[model samples]
Target: MREPADVAVVGTGVVGLAVAVELLHRGLDVTVVGPRTGAHQGQGTRAAGAMLSTFSELEPQHDAVRAGMETAERLAAHQAYPAWLERIEAMGGGTVQAPSGTWVLAPAGRRSCLDPIAAAARAAGHSVEEHDASSIPALRAPASSAGALWLPTESRVDSAALMEALSRAVEQQPRATWISQSATAVSAGTVACTEGETVRAREVVLAAGCGIPALLPECGRPLGVPPILAGRGVSARLAAPGVEVEQVVRTPNAEFACGAHLVPRTDGTLYLGGTNRLTLDADPAQAPSLDEVAVLASDAAALLDPRLGAASLLDTRTGLRPYTLDHLPLIGRTGDPSVLVATATYRCGVLLAPRLAQLVADEITAPGSLDAHPYRALRPMPAPRIDDVLADGAAQGLLEHLLQGGGHLPPAQQDEFAAFTALALRALLDEGSQAGAAVRRLWERAPVIEAVPALFALARRLEGVR
Candidate 1:
């Protein structure tokens, strides 16, 4: 048994720590519960490039309203990050080293992909500049390179350093108590731990990322927490002595992944990231596959510099990014008034942490302040139309295939391949009926073969509704 506090925040990831720190700043007593070690393997914060990207993440969205709101939220968070980092540092979290600016590269024949990103950035009042691929220093542009865009506003932080700082900040706060154990169950005001310890508080926040689904049943009823799937990504750290870039170098979001990106860490090592495989459940013990690492290396070589392929592979990390069906975060109060859910941030957890923390604190201090907030945890998010799903699926699938060496084919063959992919997807949808439709929808959002279990669950749910 532990003394009741003002709040009990489950999970110690970026979001959980951010929320706890924010609440503590508001004069609240907090009990932070979560394991401090290997528990975070495959979790987003541990393996994230932590790009504070507002514009680079923008893509063409069929739902204008959703797109607009998402952009607004990301922009708000991007603006607040610097100040927020300053505050954390002041609390003894240590300084977070984040290099300024990012180069968004467009490979040959993919100029169309960069157009929408640049347009969205301009509409949001950010400056974007186009430059010849070869003009960028330290880049060994492939012969098929198209061009590049300079986004001065985008940047990336060393995720491991940031996480250490957050932990230090929370540990320094006298009003916060850190429990080094996994939370087995959570309810309105009580959280049961793995060791049979129960901590009670007036309010509870579930920020456990992919762990949310498991604890939801213990809440005694539905919390309106949306279905969360894991977007598993594999990233590698390379010690390429002669290969270096001053800033973040990445491609525009491609297929269901964030695309290949390189982030320079303070220690002279480079972070190479760009693979997304969605799954129904995340395995913390899962290791990165050789094939995945090979793709990352080849993509880095093709898109950024050839030296990356020869770079010494220092280590590889896996992160399971939690996402919803519609690919938006589920924040704010859930069906349980006393419990708020703030997971499913997908690819932008680190970028959006500070803003989301503020949002969570505001809701706690003043309920109904975010009643009209678009990402309310239990809000209705119907699936996109079947036709829209098929269209986007084919387009993204083709892009993914191309990025994975399919682009080597002749232009005419590439077009034929695109048509063939679209036809195959249509056939899959038609033959599998409702189940096929559900899988196709999930595939477009996260085109990974490992997503079949989640796809089936979605199919059954939709079937029940019908």
Candidate 2:
């Protein structure tokens, strides 16, 4: 068993690698343990679609959407693609794209997806345009009815090149060691790898993506938080005739349906993705489904220019995404001081990496400034588990009615509506509700009809009832 270093980061994927670099930069001795050999070396990083549109992915009212946007801005300005690009250029890792904008297509049928989101974005004071599909040459090339939302400041990075650069960056640091080993468990203040090498550390961070809970069971409920689930994302890259797309393109639908993203690089190869499937099976070798590739390719052809039609399929890949029940990421230290669990950024891992790394690093290095209250290992309220989602749905429906036309219901129905509304509000206000903040966030975006208790409350507050 090797003595512990200052920090032992399990899993050398983008998240782990980023944390390793950050810790080393802060003058800490760090050991990155992972199967960074054979077929697994850099698999997660290689499979990423690497879009840096922090605020564009979700409903704008989401705390993470706002936080992600701010985080992306800070990382782009201080520590992401630019720094990565410089390092890649030095390493001669071919070419990379540093585009400053992201383009999203909103098909007419799916326009409802953006109404509330656009309203939310407006609340955040961001300029959002609903451009008809014809507005974009590549999008128009596909003959779709959707318009586009252009976020001019967002960017994309060549993930593979970026990962290689990170490897180089870590090598440059004298105190950093990228050890080839799989971490099996975390005990007390030490991490024991599968190969029996133990590294002691003042701080141990489990950034192993979907493999997290399996590596360290304590992390699953660290201080009573919910367990992390694995969200599988499959993607394929195509060799194209250098389609000139100024920004990343995504179609918003109930599901990603015809949703496809086209990320172009100077190398004439574009990375298209991705099918997000939730599963407990964590196999990296699972090839992209032929059906998925065909669909993705078809969607890309519809959304991209003629050049993409002539492109050949180069390769397909898959990786596991750590998803929490609530979409927000799990960052900061656990109630257990020595073990810090930083996983579950979902699909936004790349977008959230730099900020998350810095946040974790800051907490570990300068503990006084960060208030772990919000991200406390022991959540002040019980987290909403997967089973609770069903109940939350019913409560959501009741609350909507009361907020809207509950007063319009007949007197007999009004009392029932009032009862339903009260129950709903009580559950919503309860921190233990599985829906967590999603119910409130959604309500803020779209008003609901008043049904039960809300109707009663309104009738009582107002002069007269029916």
Candidate 1 Cα deviation (angstroms), residue 307:
1.7
Model 1: worst 10 consecutive residues (lDDT sum): 448-457
TM accuracy, model 2: 0.73
Reference-based TM-score of each model: 0.90, 0.73
Top-lDDT candidate index: 1
Badly placed stretches (over 4 Å) of model 1 are: 61-64, 218-221, 393-396, 410-416, 429-466
lDDT of candidates 1 onward, in order: 0.80, 0.61
lDDT of 1: 0.80
RMSD of every candidate to native, in Å, equals 4.6, 10.7
lDDT tens digits, residues 1-466, model 2?
A: 4566888888877888878877877788988888654656225566777887544666423355555554444344334656645643554443455666677776433455556545545665666677766676444444544456766656787787667666677777778777788888875578887777778888888888777777666645654445666656677777765465656776542231114677776576778874554454567667777765765665566544545667788887877777565545777666567777677777667766766777788888887434643443444543453224323343433433233211134556755764665565546645453353544543332222212223223324433522
